[model samples]
Target chain A: MMSVGELLSQFGDKYLQALWTTYGLTVLCFAGALVLGIAITVMRICPIKPLQWFGDFYVQIFRNIPGAALLIVLVYALPYLRVMLSYYMCVLVAVTLIPSSFCSEYLMAGMNTIGAGQIEAARSLGMTFFQIVKNVVLPQALRSTVLQMTNLLVATMLTTALASQVPLNPADLTGIVTYINTHAVGGITAFMISAFFYAVTAVVIGQIGNRIDKKVRILR
Target chain B: MNGAHASIRDVLYDAPGPKAKRRIAFVTVISLLALAALLAAIVRRFYVTGQLDPKYWSIFLRYTTWRFIGRGLLGTLQVAAASSVLAFAAGMLLMMARVCRYRVLNAIATFIIELSRGIPTLLFIYFFFLLAPQFGLQLPSFWRITLPVSISAMGVTAEALRSGVNAVPRGQTEAAVSLGMRSASVFFKIVFPQGFRYVIPTLISEMVIVFKDTTYAYVVNYADLMQNAKVLISNYDALLAVYLVVAVIYIVINYLINKLAATVERRTRAAVAAAK
Candidate 1:
């Protein structure tokens, strides 16, 4: 078992690299989820019945499947069907798919808060369909979901822990803990160091989210 | 009508005029065809890749296979039930401490809640799986998964419970106090019960999360559904079929739990409205 000082001095560089990797994965996955989520939300609320059903089916499937299960299928099972993704790609796909479902749900909830009367008002002004969506629906939904998207960012970071399941070139934060524990008797200090990084990042995200939410929150 | 069930679907468009209806109908037909084409393409890929072979899927036809998966599901349910109970208890205690007038307790409780909620469950599981043993705390595999899962869940549960408590009208507490009731007794008998009732739906939804966390039981080598699915995979040499089926099983179970939560939420809303 390594002491706290010994652990940090010995593995300080790895911890920094792991933190960077975690940050990179979180950002990329979240960006992907947001784009995909917005598309799904559009499908869900669109007037086309089949597209709406497809969107609903997509959300239910992704939202209900466990992260580990999805990762395994993406990494292992997909190969059987001749659709092989790299380890990183599999992790990215799994992480993005799960959160996109949630992101869509939050967006829908935010959109629901915008009353029908507002749409009618927009229509009376001769706003085109796309114009109403862009000017009215999108702005309110995006603003109101600031906090939820913030939490989703944190959740995306956590989901990157799934990276530990696969062997990546530079492991993420969770993967580093596993790396250290296996190679050396890093003990509780190893776990604590990683946990500290996660907690601090989460706190920072929460504070920023609160500030933004306060600015943009609709009183109604 | 100014109904409460107004959703984004209602707000996205006005009632379609004649031309708009025709356009929608045309788009619907086009989308239906596109969706069918997509499905056919996927099946074509399966056929090309030989994934549609009977050998890949035939194990499901046997009753014994289901019994094994069912047994594993029972294990999953057991872990989920235990963790949910433990998390609920911890959450209640934390919520009470948070609301009470003790500064020290409040600070400590708040810290724990943040720590638990902020950190990922995998980190907690690693703490138990890897770190605890170094300190001579050797937990069984079951406890390894259950403890961390419950710990991860308790913080969110505490927040949910606190929200429910906040929703309870201040007048109710004041009314109880004016009736000469003690604080703790009043809380337990009057405030907490109503608060608990208010959050029943939220708690049930939280159970979906707890059940999902239990899927991490694989790390500790616990015989939850995923673990058992691994066993079946090894024995049958059918990775795609077994894993896909297992994933469906999880989705279905969670879907049902969500439906149950929605039903409870609707009924409670009605009951509360009727009471008003």
Candidate 2:
């Protein structure tokens, strides 16, 4: 993974490991975002308008604000308010809240597409509200939104790489490049390293997304 | 029983089902449960680290990170503004080329769009940043590094504009051409006015992305929020508190912007579509 020149050896796992830390932070942040995004989306679709507004506002801000700026507010400003979270936590928080807006929008559209006749039929049978939704509507909605959700999820994964800008240690594959770059310091080597890692990740995620999407569409 | 039948809406995609309330409730429950689990895990991770000291939080607040945040914000805005305009212009030019009788212009526009659409945006910018430095033509840093950020922004803005321009129909151009109008005026008067509406939501989304992308500056070690957060995280390891704050703020800002976009999308959709 390394040439181990004097400069590279000096930093050792220092730079490389930092890249790993970046990976960890990124994964955690997106994972959090995926979950939170789903939840906010659900809230938006619920029967309550108040909860919907709450969800809407959550999505709007997360969607609007710059990721870095948001990260700053979390990292630097919160402590001022006595609600300080760590940098890792801050990145996760930002990613989760922001991405949720996207997920909810996608999901709501899916929910909205379900035919009204089915619901009325279930109501005619006097089925419980939760049972009718779970057994009937969601299955249909899920079918329609599956391809879309897959795309959004993959896009979210790639976008989450932005977490690296929190100055990800550039370890892992990018670490090798980061290693070379710091040695070359201000050289294209670092850029190339990150680009390579990003490409690999993007391709992998894109392929997975495409495959799942294709499968979903086929059945649909 | 008589009230059971209500007037059905004409919109094709509007309704879910009659048991809408029940379905919504189910979705709500499942969503909350999952979110709760994620929050719990983060909390667990937070407590495991055991560095929730107020002294550290205080020290963290008093750091130079605030200055970096301000500067980083400015950098983010600069890139968003510049690239958005550039992207729109580029998109329009490309759109016109796509619609033009000239094969050469159409080919060029198609090539540009394909080249951009195929690549991961970050990779594009990373490469662009390298090349921009070579030419000494990039977004300059007024408060921070300008060139890198702007190039990245331009790439995305360009994509948005392409779509905007395409939304215009051939009829408008044909009418303009019949009036003996030149290509440039047709674009400015007929195509642009109509196309720019489509670009609005996309432009807003691009702006959000650009702002988010300012975090990319951290890769170059330019001080931005994400970069600062990482530094602080390692320096203090207050991962939870920091992330919670970051998530809330990002959500808050993005929420406002998207709301405006949604409002515009609704109004425009009604005004533009119904008129037809």
Per-candidate interface C-alpha RMSD?
1.5, 7.7
Q: Where does model 1 exceed 4 Å of error?
A: B1-6
TM-score of chain B of each: 0.95, 0.69
The sequence of per-residue lDDT tens digits that candidate 2 reaches over residues A1-220 is 2333544465556656654664565566556765676667555544544565567667666556655556566666556455768555666676666566666666556655556777777767876545665676556655666656655554554454444444443433333443454455535544554554544554566567677666654242
Clashing pairs in 1: none
Question: What is candidate 1's fraction of native contacts?
Answer: 0.74
Predicted structure 2: clash tally: 48
lDDT of 1 by residue, A1-220 (tens): 7888899899889988999988988999999999999999888878888998999899999989989999999999999889989999999999999999999988887887887899999989989777887899888999999999999998899889889889987888888888999999998788888888888898899999999999999989
lDDT (tens digit, per residue) of candidate 2 on B209-245: 5556555565556555555566666876666555555
lDDT of each: 0.90, 0.57
The positional error of residue B188 in candidate 1, measured at the CA in angstroms, is 1.1
Candidate 1 lDDT tens digits, B84-182: 999999999999999998999999899888888888888888889888988899999999999999999999999999989888899999999999999
- DockQ of candidate 1 relative to the true structure: 0.72
